[model samples]
Structure formats: C-alpha cells, structure tokens
Target: MNELFTRIVSGVIYAAAIILALWSGKLATNILFIIFGLICLFELQNLLNFKNYVSYFVFPIALIFFNYFNVNDEITFLFIIACLFVKLLLLRDLFSLKGRNAFRQKKHLITLMYIVPSMVFLTLIPKLYPDYNTYILLYVFILMWINDSFAFLIGKHFGKQKLFAKISPKKTVEGFLAGFTFTIIGGILISYFNQTLSFYNWVVVGILVSVFGNLGDLVQSKFKRKALVKDSGKIMPGHGGVFDRMDSIIFSSTFVFGFLFVINHVS
Candidate 1:
C-alpha cells in the first residue's frame, strides 16, 4: 500500500478507535487500557527480544488485576503476597533469557514500572479528588494526541533543527514546540471546566504535559531506534503500535496525575 493511503487509513482507524473507546464509558475505558497494556507489553517483548512467554502475559495481567484486588478487603493479602513472591522469583527468568528475549520476557515488569503506578493513581484519583479528575485525565490524553499529531505536521513543515537525530531523525525542535504549545492548551481549556484549577495550575500542568510528554515521545523513538524498527506494529496503518499512539500520554498521565494530587493535598 502507498504511504499516503496507509497514513489516511491509519488516522481514521485510530481516531475511530479512540472515540469508540471513550464513548464506551469508565469500565470500558479501563478494559480498553488493559488491552492496550497487553499489546504494549507484547510489542515491547518483541522489540526488546524477550523470550519467556509466561512473563510476557502473566505479569502484566497480574499487575493490573492484583492492584484491582488490593482495592478490597475481600481479596486476600495472602494471595497478593503470593503473586508478589512469584513475580519477584521471575527475576531468574530475566537473566536466563539472552539478547532480545530478555526484553520480551521482562517486558511486563518494564511496563509495570510505568503503568502499574499510573493505573493505581488513575483508579484512585476520581474517588479521592472531585471535579478535578475528568479534566485532568481528559487533558492528559488529549494533549498527548495533540503533541503527537501536530509535532509531525510542524516538524515536517519547519523542522530544520534536529532535536534527537540519533534517536528519531525526523523530530525537530520546531516541531516539538509546535506540538507542545498546542497540547498545553488542553490543560488551560480543561482548567476552565475543572473549577479547581487556577490559571497558574493550568500553566504548570501545561508545561509539564508538554515537556514530559515530548520526552515520552523521544523515549519511545529511542526504543524504536534500538529495536531497528520504524513503528511498533502495523495496527495503526500509518501510525505505530499502541505504544506509539499512547507514548506521550504514558508520561503525561503520571505527571499530571501526581501534580493534581500534590496540589490538592497542599490546599
């Protein structure tokens, strides 16, 4: 297929998927994230060249599920403890796998380092803080999309100066600024509705979302460079893997999530 055709198809499908997912409501959103989490783990495994299929699947699912169980008194601490023990013991398997398989096998834990805590924060944010979460989460995600999409266009048009040519040759400082500026608007606009956020908070979150979000993109690009792969997967047609799609959101979510919590507590 032609690159243009691929890109067009990819954009439509991804936009559709995201819309459908958001429309599906909270439970559906969580489920969708879980599915994406699995895909990311799998892709990372392949990219990193991990070998153990058991680690590839079990731990990602377990991390989320265990965290879920931890929510209730009903789910035994003993069970969670056992899972933790097994999860820790799996370290041997990581060393056992050589080369690419090491990453593939350990992909779950690697992502666990990122997603588990974020999900925990997400799961609790709405309940712990009110009126703030909807906008925060919305900005976290929308800004990420803005960053990814505009960065591409801006970079293409005026990306004379390379930002990280060694990692992602195409990314440029001009594109980064363009992407960051647009995405930051999400924080400000969402702030209008949030009631709790002042203009200052909006500015801070916006800066954070843009800065860390761009860093997140660069981080993923570096990974792709190491893997010697262009895109994470073919699912997005012109886009890449779920990893590619959600790269900025991964960092933005955590950064925004923590920022709000800390601010809310301080006040």
Candidate 2:
C-alpha cells in the first residue's frame, strides 16, 4: 500500500513537471529535457559501466548544437539515420545471447549515440510543423502514458504468458496487447480534440509509439540485467530513476519524429 502511494505521488510530480515545462514554451522544454537527458545519461553510464565522464560534458553540447543551431534538414536526416542505425543494433543486441558485449569497446560513442540524438529528435517533434506546436509533442507523450498505464494495470491483474521472460519476466503478452489497443483509441480521441493530425496519421503514430515504447522498456530492462541492478537509480522512490521514467520516450522519440517529419514533408 505504501509502495503504491509512493508510486502515485512521484508519478504525479514527474508528470506535473513535464506538463509545466511543455506549457512554458521552447526554452523551458529544452532546459527540462536537457536535465532529464543528463540524468538518463548518468544512469546509463552506470549501467554501461562508463568510467570516463566525457559524455557528461558532450551531451548538453551536442543537444544544444542540434537544437539551437538551425542545422539543415540534411544534417538532421543524417543524425536521424545514425540514431536509427544504432537503435537497430541495440534492438538486435537485446535479443541476442551475447547481449551488448560487441559494443562494449565503443562505450562512449554508444552512450552519445543512444541518448543525445534521441532527445534532440524528441525536441524536434514540436517543430515538425510550420510553427512550434506543443500539442503534437504532448499528444505523443499522452499516447505513451496511456500505453504504459494500460500495460501495467492490465498486466498486473490479468497477465498470463510472459512477453520476454529472459529479459523482463513480469511483462505479459496480454499487457502489451491491451496497451496497443488503448493507445489507438487514445490517438483517435486526441485527433478528435486536437486535430493536429488526421485520424489515420494519429492512429499510425499510436502504433509506432506503443510498439517502440514497449521495446524501449525491454531494452532498458536488458541493460539493467547486464548491470545486475533492479532499478536504474534511486532518484524516483518507487519508479527508480529518471532513465527508468524516460526510457520509453527515449526509445520511441526518433521513430516518432522521423514519421512526423516524413509525413510533414510529403503532405
């Protein structure tokens, strides 16, 4: 009971912070995410056993460069490509018995590639339209929250078959399906209310976010397994750490931004 109360309190506080940051506009959002990205990097550094602290310095610089410099679309495209490639490799490593051993030698590069660019793309999401629209980014997060919430609630009460027993023993197939279903519904409702995107596009976005978000959770779980730690850190009492909270968004951001970017250009 106390655990549940703690989770609820921390979760509300975290959500409030994000909402306020988003509502405040560009600079506030960037500052909030930069702080989040740094915390995530710190947790990931511990998970990956990073001894060097260069990433602590490199993260904000890279984020600021990509975010504020008004770099051309070509550069952004290349950066997205690089993030996708590295993420795909991480996905492959997630399922492999060897795990992330292959990339252990390039720890710093992997750290920079994995965390920094994803956050950059996430911020770019709001700017995908002609103007900076916070609604789109907020909706993306809304769908993620919906998916995650249903996954947990449904999983806890009715979960039977394990989704990834080796990596995340608690996750069930039933939970994933529930999350996916509700996310699509949430997308449709958001479309009705916000009209940021067409119904079809929002549906597609829901699918992408749900599928990738869950995968992100799994990926983080694999990292925790490798690190032999239960939670990423003690930052959030019941929720673990900032990385623990942001893993789904971190993993899904690139794909969501890419999809929106392509559609925005094509449309």
Structural similarity to truth (TM-score) of each candidate: 0.74, 0.96
What are the runs in model 1 whose C-alpha is more than 4 Å off?
Answer: 52-111, 118-128, 131-135
Q: Each model's C-alpha lDDT?
A: 0.62, 0.89
Candidate 2 residue-wise lDDT, 1-267, digit = tens? 999999999999999898998899888888998899988988998998886577778778877887678888888889889999888988888777764553466676678888989988888898876567877898899999999999999999999999999989999999999999999999999989988799999999999999999999999998898889999999998999999999999999999999998898788
- Distance (Å) between predicted and true CA of 248, model 2? 0.7
RMSD of each: 6.7, 1.4
lDDT, candidate 2, residue 70?
Answer: 80
